[model samples]
Target: MFTPSSALTLEQGWQTTGATGSLQKLKKFNNQDFNHLRTSCLSQGVLFEDATFPAHVSSIGPNLLPEDKLRRIQWKRPTELQRNPYLIMDGVSRFDIMQGEIGDCWLLAAVGSLTLQKKFLENVLPKDQGFQDGYAGIFHFRFWQYGDWVDVVIDDRLPFLNGRYLSVQPRTSNEFWPSLLEKAYAKLRGSYQNLHGGYLSDALVDLTGGVQMAFSLKNPPPDLEEILKAADKSQCLMGCSTSGPLRRNIEVRNGIVQGHAYTVTGAVKICYKNGWKHIIRIWNPWGHGEWKGPWCDDSPQWDHVEPKCREALLRNKDDGEFWMSCENFQEQFSWLYICNNTPTFLDFGDQHCTKWSVDSHISLWSPVLATGRNYSPGAVSMNPQYFFKVPDYDPKPYNIVVSLMQKHAEDMHNAKTLKIGFLITMENSKVLEQFSRTRDITKYFTLSPGTYAVVPATTEDQEFEFLLRIFMKNQDYNENSNFPPSPVLPMDVPRQNQDRSYKAVFLRYTKQDSAIDASQLQQLLNDVILQDEMTSLGGRFSFDSCRGILALMDLNSNGRLTLQEFGRLWRSLTKYMDIFCKEDRNHSGFLDVSELKSAIQTAGLAANEQLLCLMALRYGDAARRIGFSDFVCCMLRLETMTNAFQNLAEGGSQVLMTAMEWLTLVMYT
Candidate 1:
C-alpha cells in the first residue's frame, strides 16, 4: 500500500470542529524543494531545469492518435515561445486558458470555474514567482491530492507540437501562467497523455479540495436555479457537462461541444420582453466554443433586453464564454458539478452556513483486515469503521455529506482501481450506496440525532488507500485554547505484545553490552517496531529523543540505559502512546494545549496551568498543537524535573542540587 505523505498542510489547517482527521502536511514532489533549487540556479547563473520530471519524450507518454504521430514534439522554454513573456499580462481572467491538441478539457473546465473565485484564487495558484527578477525557469502550483493539498513544481520547458505548444495554449502570446499551471498538473499526473479523459469531479476536488456534488441536467431539479444562485453567492466552482452520443463532442453545429465540460461562471435574469429569463454563463475550456441557441452572444434575444442590461450581460466575443438560457443549458448539458469548501447551498435548512463541520480520515485497505462485501453481507464487519455523533441540539434533521476518494498512482490512468463503496450503519439498519471504479463517490443523508458508523470497503479484499470526508451541518468548530485543566487522574494503557524477541533485539543493538546509549536505542526501537505502527506512534524515535529518554531513565546519571532501565522506559512509552491517542480526538498526530493538559494528567502526571502553557509554547506547532515526538520529549522532561526536585527538596517545592548534578541533568535531557 502507498504510504500517506508525511507533509502536513500548514496553511490549510485541520479545524477539528466535527471532523475526525487532521490535514496531512504536503511534501514537495520528488523531494525537490523549489526555492532551494531556484537559489542554486541563480547562484550558478543558469536557468533551472527539473531533472526529476525532465522535459523528455517519456514525459509526454506514448502517442495515442494518428494526428499525434504527425507532430515532432519538443520541449521549449517561455523565452523560446515568445519575447517579453509575462506570467500574468492583465490579471488572471476566466478566458486565459485555451485548449491545445490534448483532449483533457475536463481538467481545464475545472480550472475555468475556479477563475471566477477572486477572493482566494491565489491560494490555489500562488502568484509569487514570475518570469522576471527572481525567475529561474521554475514554477510551483498547489493541487489537492485525495485529502491533503500538495505543491507540485515543474520546469518552464513546455511540450511543443511541431512549432506550436502542445495540450494547453496561453490566451495572450506572452502570458504563460495558464500553460505553466497545466504543466504542473501534467507533471503531477505523470504525463500530458495521462490527462486525456478524467472525471470532472476529480479535477474539481483537486482544484478546490472541497465538497463536490454533480447534478443531472436531463431532469433538472426544480431548485436548480435556486441552487445555482446560492452556489454563486457561496462562491462555489461549478461546471456543466454534455452527455449522449449526440452531444459526444463530435457534434459542433449546435455550438455546443458534446461530451464536453464547460464552466458555469454565473446565473442571471435579464429583463427581456418584461419576463424573467434564467441565464447561465457557461465557458468552454477550448476558449472558443459557444451555444448557437437562444440568448447566445449574437442572438437577437439581446435586442429585447434593456440597453443597460444588454450591455452588462452581452459579450459578443468568441472568447469561449457565452450566456445561454437555462432551458437551453438543460437541453445541451447532461450534468452540472458544483464544488465548494463552504457548502452553504446544501438542502439543509441551515441559517448560518458557517456552523457546518467537516471530518476527514485517511486509511489503508489492508488485505488481511479489509474483508469486503463481495462474498457475503456480513463481511463488511471486518472493514475499518469510524464513528461520529449527531447531538439533539436541533430538532430538524441535519444534512450530512459523505465523500470517499481513492488515492491513485502517479500514472493514474495505469493505476489499479477497485469497485469501492461505503456503508452507513445506524440503529441496526445498514445503508449501502453504489460501488464503482470511479475516483470519488459521494452521498447525502438527512440524519437525526444518533451515533453513526461509516464503514468504507471495496468489492474484494485488497490493499489500497482512500480518504473519507464527512461534512455535518450545525457542528461549530469550537477550538477553544483556554480549556479547563483536568483534575489529577490516572488512565489505563492496554499492555502490548509480550514477545521474547526483545531480548535478542536488545542484544543485537547493544552488541551484548550491559547498557546502550541514545543512538543504539533509536536503531533498536525503529528496527523492532513495524513502520506503520511506528508512524502512528509519533514516527521513529530520533537519537535526540532517545538521549532525552536516557536522561529521564538513567538512575546512575551516566547518560546510558541498562536493559532494566529500558524496560521501565518501554512501559512508560506504551502508556504515553495510549494517553496521546485518547486525547488526540481528531487523530491528527498532534494535540492542542487542551488535549495536552488532559494527556499529561492521564499519564499519572499533572502539570499546573502555568506548566501546561509553557509546554504548549515549547513543543506545539504553529497551530499550537504538539506532535507525538514533542509530546514524548515533554513528558520525559516533566518526569525528570519532578523527580529531581523531589529527590533534593526540603519542602515539596524547594530543591538544591550540586553544580555537577545540575550540569549533568541540563546537559543530558
Candidate 2:
C-alpha cells in the first residue's frame, strides 16, 4: 500500500549483466570477450591485437599533434622499449603514475588515488596478468561505465615521440604496468586525446563504480575536517583542484596550477609538542609540484614536530605528495571531490550508520519525443518523468544524491555534449543544478519525508541516451507508475465497409501466400487509409516508418505479416478511427492531448498523466496535435504492449523480469 505521506526508500542502481557473479566477471568491451580471445590467441600461438581499438593514427586522435602526420611517432611493444621488463616490479604506487605529455591529470589524480587502496586496484587491475608467462601482448583493465564494469582489452603497444613516451610514464625504467594501464585507459575512452581533459570525479567513479560528492571549499563547511577524516578512514578516493579553467595546466601561485587536478591522499591531525595541527595530504598527478605554504614539506613550522613524526609524515622530495593545513587547503582549493564505493560515510547520525540505497533508470529521448525544454509546463511535462518517494523518518531530513549521466553517443565523436539537467518536484526544498554539458551532473538533496518526481531532460530536440540514478537512505521506497490498471472498454471490430476496403487493398498488394512485405504493407496502407478523407495524415508514411511498423508487428520474426495478422490489426485500426472521430469534437483535424487521453480511455486502456504525457510526446507533433494516422499507431502500440504484459503475467498479479529479459520484451514487442 502507498500513501502520499509515506516515507520513500530507494533501490540500488541497475547495471550491465553478463557472466556476472564475481569480481572477475565483467561485461565485454567492443563485444570482445576476454576469456574467448585469450584462449584462441594462446591456442593459435598468435599475439592478440584488438582491431576495435587498433594502435593507429586514428586511435591516437588528432588532438595530440597540430600536424599528426608531420610528427615522427613510433608505436612499440614494452619489450622493444625496455630490456628486462616486468609487469609489476615491487607493487603499484602513486609514484609510478608520472604524467608525461598527456593533459589528463584529472585521470592521473584518480589513478594515483586508486593505487592507495589494494581492494579497488585489484578489482580494476586484475593481478593474474603479467608480461612474461603466457604473455600474448594483450592486457585488459576494467572501468565502470554508467553502471557496468567493462573489460577494455588493449595491446601492449605504447606511443612514443622520438624515444619518449607520450602519455603516463613509470618511475622504474623496467616496470611497465603503469604505462600499459594508461594505454588500456586510453583505449577504454575513444583515445588518449579524449582523456586529455576530464573531471577527477568522473575518473574516480569509473575506477570504483562509486558515488562522488563534490564540496566547494571557497566557503568550507564547518565540519569539513570531520568529513575528510571520515572519507579517508573509509578508504574513499579523494581529489581537489585549484581555481582555473578545467583544461589549463599552467602553474599559477604557490606551486598550484590553474585548471590542474590533484588527489587527496589522507586527512590527519598530527600532534606536535605544543598542539595538534589539521593536515590535508595532497598529491599532484604531474609528479613534480610543491606547495611552499605553512606545514609543507620544508616549512619552518616542521621544526616543532619530533624527528619520528618528521621522518614518517614529511618528505622533502619532488614526489608531488605534500601536506597543507586544512585552513590553507580550504582557501586555495576550488572544489573537493570524494568518491566512495557507495556514499555511506557522510551520514551524520554516527550511531545509526545506515548505508544509502540507489536505483537507476536507463532511458532515452527519441526524435518524436525529444522536444528540448523551456519553462512551459507542457514542455517540461513532455520530457521523461520518473517518480520515487524519499523516507526521512528522523527529525532531520535524510541525505540523498541524484545523478544524471549521459551515455556516450555519436554526437560525442566530434566533441559534442548535450546540455542536460533535471528537476525535483517536491514540497519545501527545491534541489537543482545549473545546466552544463558534461558527462555527469550530480546534486545532493536533504529532502523532507515525502514522495517526489524526478524529471531529466536535454536542452535540444536531439536523441541522446541517459541514466537517472536516485540514492537515499531507509526503506519502503518504490515506484508506482503502473498503478491504477486499465479499465475494460467495449470491444468492437472493423466496420463492414472498412473491412472490405482493407481486404481489397491487401489482395491487390500481398503475395499469393496471403502475406505482405514491408513495402507492400506501406503501399497497401497508403492506398487504403486515404480512401476516405476522414483519415488525415500529418505526413505520408515514409519507407523507414513503414519498416518500423513491420518490425513492431512482426510476431513470427519473419520479414512480413500474414493475412491473419493483418486482419487482427485491421480491427484495432478501425476501432482507433472511431475513438478519434468521437473525441475530435471540434473537427480540428488533429486530436490534442485531452482528446487523445479521452480516446485512450474510450479504447479501454490506461491514460495516466505520465503515460499520456509520453503519448503526447510520441504521437503528437510540436503543438501536441495527434493526427489520424498517428493516433491509430499510438493506440495500437499501447494495446499491443498491454497484451504482451498480460500474456507474460498469466496467473501472476504483476510481471517480473531481469534487465536483459525486459530488454528482450521491449525490443521485440
Candidate 3:
C-alpha cells in the first residue's frame, strides 16, 4: 500500500528544513512573496496605524514623557529617546513615532488603532534585531493578517504640523506653545507623504473613528414651517431654507426627504464692515456647512436672536452637528416627485423581430404591428427569403433569411402583385437572411429607391442554387398568382468573368472476388510513389499513382468500395508469405531436406511441415522455384503481424505466411 503525503505535513517539513530552495519553490507555486501578499491585502482594505492609548488610563503608566521632559527631549537623537511624545500633526493628533515621514495618514491611523489593541502591535513588531537594526533603521514587521513579513526602513526626519521639519535645535523651555503647534499642524493637513497624500476621513476611520460625510448648502424645503408645526416633542428636528433664486422645488412625500437638509443648532452676532448684525452658524457634519444667515451684518433679524441664540446654538454643535430653519421645513420628506403630465405610450409595435436557425432550416416570426394607431384588417404582410452559402473547405451548410413587408398605400396600383426582385451572386450567397422592405432603404438595405428590388449578388447560378424557396401567401389570396410576388428576393447575378467549369464523378468496388489484395497493393503502390517522390525520381514512374490505386480498389467499377473488399485487401497484405522463404532459407543453391526443416522451425511452423510443404509445392513450380519478388509480396499480405506470429509459433504455417506478408507490406509501403 502506498501512503500519500499530506500537504500540511509536507509544508511543515519544508518549514523545518530552512532550505532556501524549498522556500523559493513554494513561493513560486503560491505566486507570491511576503511583500506582494502584504500589498495585495492592504489594497483590498487592510489598514494599519499607530494607536496610542493614554498610558495612565490603560494602566500602562507614564509611557510618554512629561510636558517638561518632552519639551527638552533632543528630537534629532531619536535613538536616545526613552519616552514617547504626543503631537498634533496634520488635522488629527496621533502618538506613534514613525521613523520616516510617510504621507499615508489613513494607513497610519489604522496602524494606531491596531496599537490600541496591544496584541495587534505585538504581533507585527520584529522580534530579532541582529545586524538589521543599524542600517537605514531597518526592521522586520509582519502584516499578521496577510501572513507576510517584510523589512521597513525608518528615516530620522519627523513629520511636523506645517511640513517635515528637522529638529535642528532641541527646546529646553518648560512652557511650550502647544496651541501654536496645533495650528501649525492643521496647516499641513493636505500635504503629501512619500507618494500618497493624506485624506482625513480615511485616516479617521483607520483610527477606528467614524467616517465623515459631505453636505451641500441648498435652500431649505418649502414645507419647512409645516414640518416644524407637525414636529413632536421628542423630535428635536427643525428646518431652514437657503435664501436664493428658487431654481427648482423639491417634493416631500412618504417618509423620504427630497432635498438635502442638515440639523442646525447655532447662531452668532458680529459687527461687519457694513454694520453690526446677526449671523447663524450651521454645522454640516460634512464639516463645511456655512449659512448665509439673517445674522450676518445686514440681517434684519440681528437684534432679535443674535447673542442669545448664538451661545445656545454654539453649545449644541459638536463634531457631528447640523442646522435648519422652521420656515423651510416640510411636514413630510420624500425624494420622489411627479413632474409634468404628458402622454406616454407603453406598448411598442411590430418594430422588433425574433429569429432562430438550426442545421438546414431557418425560421422567423413577426407579430402584428402596434403603432398606437387604429387597427385595420390585413394592414401588414411579410415575405421572408432564406439564403444558403457553403464554405470553401467546410462540408457544413450555412444560411440566412430576410423578411419583406408590403403595405396597402405603398404600392396602390399593383396592390395585388407586390413585385420585389433580387439579383443573385456568389458574395451574397452567405447572407442567409435579409429584410426586403425597410423603413429606410439606404440605412437598412443596399437597394435603390423605386428599384422594385435589388439583386443580392451578380450570379444567376447562385440564385438558382438555393435548395428551398417558399412564398408567404395571404389566406385571402392563397391560390392567386397575382397575390403579390413572393417577398423573398433573389441575389444579384454577376457578369461572366471566366468560362472554366468542373465536374465530379464516383466509382465502386467489391471484396472477395477482387484479384489483387487491394489494401496491400494500394499501400505498396503509395510507398513506391512516396519513396520515388522523396528521392526526386517520381517523374520517371509511368502510372498515375492515385488513379491506379483508385482503379485497383474499385474492382466492380460501380464507383464505390464495399466494406468486404476493404477488409479482404487489408488481411491479404498483412498475411501469407513464409512459404517462399522455406525453399531459400539456407541459400545453398537448392533446398535440402534439412534446410527446409530449419526454415519451418525458424518460421515457427515445424508442427505443420506437411501443410507448409504442400503450400510450397502449390505456389512453387515442380522444381519448387520461388522468386525473391514473389516471396516478398507474399510475406507482405498478413492481416496483422502479431497475431500471425503467435499463430506461426503455435505451428500454423499459414499464420506465419500471413504475419510476414503484413509486416512486409506495412514496412515497404
Candidates by TM-score, descending order: 1, 2, 3
Which scores higher on lDDT, 2 or 3? 2
Instruction: Please give the lDDT score at residue 18 for candidate 2.
Output: 31
Candidate 2, which segments miss by more than 4 Å at Cα?
Answer: 1-25, 68-70, 245-248, 272-275, 306-309, 366-373, 376-381, 395-398, 410-412, 427-434, 475-669
Regions more than 4 Å wrong, model 3: 1-156, 159-191, 194-201, 209-302, 314-669
C-alpha RMSD for every candidate: 14.0, 18.5, 31.4
Residue-wise lDDT of candidate 2 within 1-669, one digit each (tens)? 011111111111223433212344466777787767877899999888778777777677775677744267688888887777888888889988788888888788889999998878988888767877877778888888765678878888888887898888888888888888888788777777767766777788889877787788886767788888888888889888776654557786688777778989989888866889889989998788878888888898889988787788888899988999999898888889888765654654455435565555566665455333554455555655555555446622337778888765543455355677777765423355345566677777677666666777777667766766677664322344221111111121121211233334455576333478888877777776646555654555557667767766788878888654675566566677778778988877788888887887887776566667667777678998888877766776677677676676775656567433543344333
Cα lDDT tens digits for candidate 1, 1-669: 000111111111111111121123455666677788889999999998888678776677665344555347788899887778988887888788998887777788888887788744666677669988899898998887654567788899988777877778987889988888888888877777667666677788888777888777877666788788878777888987876442135657878876677889888766779778889998988888788888888898888989988888778999988988888888888888888874555733445323455555666676675444543345655666655556555523336778887654333345455667787876435755556566677766677777676878777655666777677665432345211111110121111111122333455577656678888887876665424342245555678777877878888899888765775676566567778778888877788888987887786666666667667777666776777777777887776666566666645655466534553444343
List TM-score per model, in order.
0.67, 0.65, 0.17
By lDDT, the best candidate is 2
lDDT of 1 at 30: 68
lDDT of 1 at 163: 81
Residue 34 C-alpha lDDT in model 1:
75
Candidate 3 lDDT (Cα, 0 to 1)? 0.26
Candidate 1: TM-score? 0.67
